[model samples]
Every structure is written in C-alpha cells, then in structure tokens.
Target: MTRAFLGLGSNLGDRMGYLKDAVAAMDDCVAVSGIYETDPVGGPDQGRYLNVVAELDTSRSARDLLELCQMLEAAAERVRDVRWGPRTLDVDVLWVDGETVDEPDLVVPHPRMFERAFVMVPLGELAPDLAEGWSDPANGDCRRLGDWDELVPPASEGIS
Candidate 1:
C-alpha cells in the first residue's frame, strides 16, 4: 500500500457538509488534518472555503485515485463551470508516495500545492515532513477551524 494525500475544499452551499461527506466516502482514508477556512484565491470573487488534507493508505494506482477523486466530487454534485471557480467540493490528489503520473488531465505531486497556503497549512498538520522547506504563498487569509473529529461529529452521534 502507498501513502497518499488528498486536498479537499468547498466554497459553496453546505461547505462543511460536503467536506464531511467526502471524507466518509474516501476509501482507506487514514487521517485528516484540521479544517481550514480561507479566502478564495482566484477566478471570479467568491466566498471562503473549508479545506483539509486527507491521508490514505491504498494499493490503488494514481489514475484510480484520480477517478476516486472525481467520484467524490460528483457525489457532492460539483460543477466545473469556471477555472479556479467556487465549488461545492474539490478533491485533489496531492501526492502519492513512490509514484509519479503525468498526463493531460492529471499530474502527481499536484503542480501547485506548494504555492498555496490553503493547501500547505492543513497538509502540514497531517505530514509535517512533506510540508517542510516550503514557502507559503500570500494569497489570502487561511486559518485552522478545527480537527476532523471536532468539526465533523460521528455519523451515529445524534442517533438514539
């Protein structure tokens, strides 16, 4: 199994709900960083985003992981109308250990992960070593909201 990281973000309706559902949908998801709320970085002006980095241990190939990302986004009903536009849920395959993939629609080690504070800040919480030696970009405000368990209650928590 390989250790992989995925970045998740939502800026539209039910942002936190979308995130919680995405996390639950991931296969072999081992750990998740604290959630962060950050201002929109690009595209037309939009609301802030709730972001988190999820860790997974899986035997799936990078392409499969990409497919899983797309599946999760679709489950959240994500719409791709504009580049870098606001989204209900965005799942990015940030990194996959000992693996590299370069294609027209996919790239491993996400081309711009290091350049965004929204990605690095939460990522650092999950994997500090990987996040080391990276300079965060001055895009906009990004702050930790809470940890996974703190922010997303257990599915059965409120049940009788």
Candidate 2:
C-alpha cells in the first residue's frame, strides 16, 4: 500500500463538522494532523478555514484518490459557482508515495502544497521528514487550533 496525504479544509458552515465527516469517511485513514485555522488564500472574500492533513495507507492510485476527494466535497454539498470560492469542504490529494499523476483534474504532490502554510503546518506535524526546513508561506496567517481528536466531536455525539 502506498502512503498518501490528503489536505482538507472547510469554511462555509460547520467547518469542523465537515472536516470530521471527511476524515471519518476514509476507511484507510491512518493519522490526522492537528487543526489549523487559516485565512482564505484567494477567491471572493470568505471566512477563515479550518484545515488538516490526513495520512492514509492505501492501494489506490492517484486518480482514485482524487476521485475520493471530489466525492467527499460533494458529500459536503460544495458548490462551484466561483473559482476558489468559499466551499463547505475542500479536499486535495496532496501526495501519494512513489506516484506522479499530472491530469487535468488532479495533480499529485499538489502543485501548491509547499506554497501554503495551511497545508504545510499540519503536514509537518504528521511527516516532518517531508516538511523539514519548511517555513511559513506568505499567502496568509495560519495558527494551530489543536489536535484532531481534541477539536472534532466524537461520531457518537453526532454532528449538528
């Protein structure tokens, strides 16, 4: 199985709820980084985003992972009325071990992952080796909110 990283964010409504639901939907999820609240990078003006990077050990290809990301976003009722616009949930296939996919809809190792602090900070928390020597990006402010377990409500409690 290849070890992959998925970046997740939500800002429209119940940001944390959207994140928790996405993380819970991944059957191969192995680890999740601490949450980071960051200013939206681009797109019409929008609220801050709650973000995290999740690790998964899976046999799925990069294309498959991209599909999964889209599925999660759809489940959150994400609308695409505007480019980089406010989203209920945003999921990206950040990296996939030993794989490179350059497709119209997907790109492995996310072309902009390294340029965004929201992605780098939490990613550093889970895989420092890949994030070593990485510093904050100039795009926006990013601050750690807390660990995933502490910030997200338990499934048993339900999301409301």
Winning candidate number (TM-score): 1
Tens digits of per-residue lDDT for model 2, 1-160? 9999999999998999899999999999999999999999978999999999999999999999988999999999999999999999999999999999887888887999999999998998889988999876585688888888987767777756
- Which pairs clash inside model 2? none
List, residue by residue over 1-160, the lDDT tens digit for candidate 1.
9999999999999999999999998869999999899988879989999999999999988899999999999999899999999999999999999988889999998998988998998888889989888776675578888888998998999999
Pairs of colliding residues, candidate 1: none
lDDT of each: 0.91, 0.92
The TM-score values for the models, in the order shown, are 0.97, 0.94
Model 1 misplaced stretches (Cα beyond 4 Å): none
Model 1 clash number: 0
Evaluate model 1: give its lDDT: 0.91
